[model samples]
Target: MHGKFKGKHAIVTGGARSIGFEIARQFCAAGAMVSIFDYNQEALEIATTTLTNEGYRVNPFLVDVSDQLQVNLAVDRAEEIAPVDVLVNNAGICLVTPFLNIEAEEWQKTLDTNLSGAFYVAQRVCRYMARRGKGVVLNMSSKNGLDGEFGHAHYNSSKAGLILLTKTIALELAHLGIRANAVCPGYIRTAMNTEVDSDEFVEEFEDRYIPGGRVGKVTDIAPIFLFLASDDAEYINGQTFVLDGGQLAGQKPWKWLLEEIKL
Candidate 1:
């Protein structure tokens, strides 16, 4: 509600739904001109309409993040309206398959969307930021990147690479006054995770994984991104903000105690 990002321009990749949509909404609410860039035309239109109707500055563009040409053109179009002040590399894909069963194309697809896509958008946006000598880039990584997830080797690898990419870019671009960082979210309630809607997964996710006793909502994450995008985090760079309710702290179990006893 505070005009933290007032008079700024931001682009949110994968802004159609879930985490990306929430980031876009927060940017708009905080007095930023938000651009929704996604591949889903229907969701793009719907999101644009809703946000614009709410008296927020919103513009939707249908583009595949993995395509460099599309990304460059979209940034160009967005710049025509206003120079982009923040870039959220939120577009990503997930494929759950056993490591042995994973196909080359499937791995490539996930990598292209999750890791390479961030590179493409970042490279493009950095051009604009370089000219202005100021901007922020926020990459979306996941807890799976830190701790491997079964049936998600490709996704894990892609996100892991993305985090390193974030760090490298941060170090390299600091001289240009561009800040880069990542957000790793664990067990967020999103459309992609239909299991969150099921009673089965909800019970499992809460009882075993998240110590917070509940899954994260989109609203839970938007503020963090907004903070990173704003000048408030000017000193925070090349770091990852983990919002997993201490999931990475490791799970408590009895078997480990027996091993410790033997030791």
Candidate 2:
């Protein structure tokens, strides 16, 4: 818990804000010389300043994960600082739209960033970890990947692909001591939903669909990522964990059914 990762390094993609930022901070708190990779230049500056001010070491890389060349270069640079002992494939974009309203370009962009981007980083990092014969790779999947949503075919498909990608990585790299896994969080409160008018909806969603009657926080999710990255979970790999406040275990609220009239 304390300074176990002092000499090690961790990389967090899309780490400029929200869940990714929280995860990055926790890793730093654990004493890892962490690197934050994000496409937003301003966010990178702010995040870097925040962490460094806390007396934790962090290297920020302006990276668009959808680009393989950038992914390779960023990883290379991160490696120059220290070998990556843990990788959190958290960079992704979610643009909501009905399936019929989805364009080819939108679908491609989502996949490129969410699924393909994870591939690029995971493969590059795993290659390094493979040589060392050990490492942890954690992909940030979503509950949308598990079940269907009203609007988000492209986003759903990308996340769904990540679960399989994680499995494949685990199976292929098991002999190499590189563990891969995914976390599916449901209805977590974050700034990613600005496009949607969901203040009232979220309250209802929590009270109804989510059995726990509350939404999740980054604090609720960040600790798990650190756990998976640690030796305690050395025996756990190639699996997906759902942190949804019991939402996945329950059924939809009456409002959802009323909207569709399944019968």
Candidate 3:
């Protein structure tokens, strides 16, 4: 427990699996007491067991971040274990439906979870951090926040709001020694992404969209979160880091470029 983050405590929402899980693991590895807030009870149990077996301090709480009451209660429970020094608002959901086909409920659900949930957690945690005069908040934004995509209007809007929310938090919390930033990832190969896309589609996507020629893995993103949470990132605030493998650097004129090139 004598590492870079020794004596620190972190809460990672959606920390049961995928990117969130990796973030929690990295924090625990760095000697931080980590609490995982996830809606999936089974996944939470599994994650807790796995981390505990690995000799890491991990506490799992069943929390639906979209509900302020639940978030508040969860925070109370986590504080009993350790005062939160870092908060990663990584819980989010995406819907793939044509704009015309998107229902009001679906749109609300996306915003409720992605934007409002982040707000609730950050606001609650910053209150405590403000008292202590130090903390870090890392939000999981997306490449869609910078650029729109087809069939993802709701998802895009939520992430876009989150980026602004991160900036707002940074502005308001800086005086209290709190830093807020967003990480925008594109096409990360997570369970959620793989559920939506086939392997063939992913291969094609890497070839056409990702200049780096590979979809990003959870490992590729976890270290960045750790860096943002550490003291080394004291000056980095209100910034959005796009970990998209150059996918957003330029437009992909797939049809035109393919027609021009034999390969």
Best by TM-score: 3
lDDT of 2: 0.92
CA displacement after TM-score superposition, residue 239 of candidate 3 (Å)? 0.6
Tens digit of per-residue lDDT, candidate 1, span 1-263: 57888999999999989999999988898899998889999999989998989999998989999998998899899999999999999998877899999999999999999999899999999988988899999999999878889999999999899899999999999999999999999888788887425868787778787767788889989899988877778999999888987788878455556478653
Task: Note the residue pairs that clash in candidate 3.
Answer: none
- For model 2, the superposed segments whose C-alpha errors exceed 4 Å read 252-263
RMSD versus native structure for model 1: 3.6
Ranking by lDDT: 3, 2, 1
Model 3: lDDT of residue 166: 96
lDDT, model 2, position 241: 93
Clashes of 3: 0
Candidate 2 residue pairs in clash (backbone atoms < 3 Å)? none
What lDDT score goes with residue 126 in model 3? 90
Model 2 clash tally?
Answer: 0
TM-score of every model?
0.94, 0.94, 0.95
lDDT of 2 at 195: 57
Candidate 3, residue 133: CA error in Å? 0.6
Compose the digit string of candidate 3's lDDT tens values, residues 1-263.
23899888999999999999999998999899999999999999999999999999998899999999999999988888888999999999988999999999999999999999999999998988999999999999999999989999999999999999999999998999999999999989988887889999999999889878899999989999989888888899999999999999886666666589866
lDDT tens digits, residue span 1-263, model 2: 77867888999999999999999999999999999999999999999999999999999999999999999999999988889999999988889889999999999999999999999999999999999999999999999889868779999999999999999999999999999999999887887874574789888777778878899998999998999999999999899999999988967557666678655
Give the clashing pairs for model 1: none
CA error at residue 245 for candidate 1, angstroms: 1.5
